[model samples]
Target: MKSLIVVDCQYDFIDGTLACENAENAVNSIIKYINSNDIKVHYSKDWHSIHNGSFKDNGGVWPVHCVQGERGARLHEDFYKHVEKDVKRPKEDNVFYKGIDDEVEEYSAYNAENSQKLSLKDALEDEVIVAGIASEYCVRETVLELLEAGHMVEILKDGLGYVDSEDHLKNLQDLMERGVRII
Candidate 1:
């Protein structure tokens, strides 16, 4: 069995505080991919506190986004509409969250845990396919971490969006060079 991990498709990274080009566009691609029956789907996000080093309010480069209990911290509406209610899709009861700390930039999905306190590493198989917003950030880190965990990892290219266009291309190339498959 293969796992499909969707990294940080939150409102802040989509059309809110840290919005980037094409992040919203990749939602449909992710939706389409998750609609398939062969894989287990998981979601991750930046569930930040009020004060963080990654927030401009502190000393980080990014604007304050994905704050707890805020609408901007939530997932895109369409993502839910497309996959949340379907009985046929993988049973998606876990939403892994990271960056709960105010000072760390915990980008990997491995840093996350669900409502039941289950780690993504425990749920995953030997193979994983990753897709999500900010190709140069969370998505990239999650894939790299998966590789470190000894999983055969693949990236869903069409299902990715980038914060930096040039870095996005470079990161994709770097991942490929490291033997991470692109699909």
Candidate 2:
């Protein structure tokens, strides 16, 4: 069965730290698609520590966001309200937490540079339809990893959005050429 992996579709990415206009606009449509499909859903979250690179105390581009137990760390308020109770766990739907360590800057749902593998990879165990924010960064990284692991991949065009449209488009094209489907 197809699994829908929502990669960092959090408030931090949609309307928080890395919020892009396109990403915010894509949220509802993505949610609708997930609800309508009735397929299993997975979400990856950037549960960063206080000293994460994206914080003011560190050298990073983004402002602090998605810190554990913070408002910015929470899911998009509207999306959360819409899909809260519906989210399954330990299998059908689970939140893969990343960026837990202070030094590692995790850009994908899979794993940080030195962390253990994401449970999402094994749980899905099949092709995954992925959608979420910052296409140029996390989305690109995750897609490549998924491909390398031998899974059929598809990106929901209207569901995933980008900060750098041009660069992200170029990367998407590269991924397409490498067999990641865009629909």
Candidate 3:
């Protein structure tokens, strides 16, 4: 079945802990797209612990955000409304929780340290449309991972944004050369 891979649309990536200006509108658009389509929606979340390396104590690239069971870790209330209550996730819509281990950093949903990784290659039976936050960082990394895993990746440019537009575009161009379709 066709899959919609939503990377880190959590509150932290929007306007919570580590909100990026570029990711705000894109996340809203991505949610709309998923709600409008029949394709299965999959999301990668950074559910970190207080002891995570990304914290102030441990040296890392970013500050701590999505801690498991915390308010920051919860999906945006607007997006969560779209998810069916009766439908248990991972069954109808797979959710890959990243950074659960707190030590190893996982950018791609297909790979995680604590939780089971979602096989982007094996799980996708049809077209895979990707959308979400921080185009220069997590978004870029996940897209490349999907491409490397041999799955066709269609990036929703309109539904996504970046911190560094120039750098993000360069990465996008490089991926395009490698066969990732941008839409």
Candidate 4:
């Protein structure tokens, strides 16, 4: 069975404080892929608390974004709309939240847990396809974790957003070398 993991396609990563370049286009492509494919879908969000260390206010490099219960923490509107119309739409339990703990800085959705506390690794199929925002960070880290866990992984290249074009390309090359298939 194949599953698709949509990683951190939140407002913050799309057009909010930490927005990435071409995020809107990436999201549109992801939505199109979702509409065209028959794969099971899962989503990850950066639901950070105010005290989370990943926030610049809390001494991290990133600006305040994806704060829990904030507008930026929500999924992109278009993606959410597509989900609402999907026959095999993911339930709330299929959406995982990361970076909730103040001291923990989680870039990978691998360890993220859903509302029911199921880890991403535990919930995903052995064969997985991934797509989402900030290709150099969350997407990259999630793919690495999937590989390390012995899963077969593919990256939907057109469905990715990145903070920097050059860094994104470099990371994609590195991931390909490490055995991730770019689709």
Top-scoring candidate (lDDT): 4
Ranking by lDDT: 4, 1, 2, 3
- Cα lDDT tens digits, model 1, 2-43, are 888888888888888788878878988888877764777788
Q: Pick by TM-score: which candidate is best?
A: 4
lDDT of 3 by residue, 59-123 (tens): 88777788888887776665666544323233323666777777787777666422444454455
Residue 136 Cα positional deviation in candidate 1, in Å, after optimal superposition: 0.7
lDDT of 2 by residue, 126-169 (tens): 77888887788888888888888888999988887788888878
Q: What pairs collide in candidate 1? A: none
Which lDDT values do the candidates have, in the order given? Answer: 0.83, 0.75, 0.71, 0.88
Candidate order by TM-score, decreasing, is: 4, 1, 2, 3
- The 10-residue segment of model 4 with minimum total lDDT is 82-91
Residues 11-102, model 4: lDDT tens digits: 98988999999899988888888888878889999998888887788899899999999999998888757754554355687889998898
Model 2 lDDT vs. the true structure? Answer: 0.75
Error of 2 at 62 (Å): 3.1
- lDDT at position 137, candidate 4: 92
Off by over 4 Å in 3: 82-93, 112-122
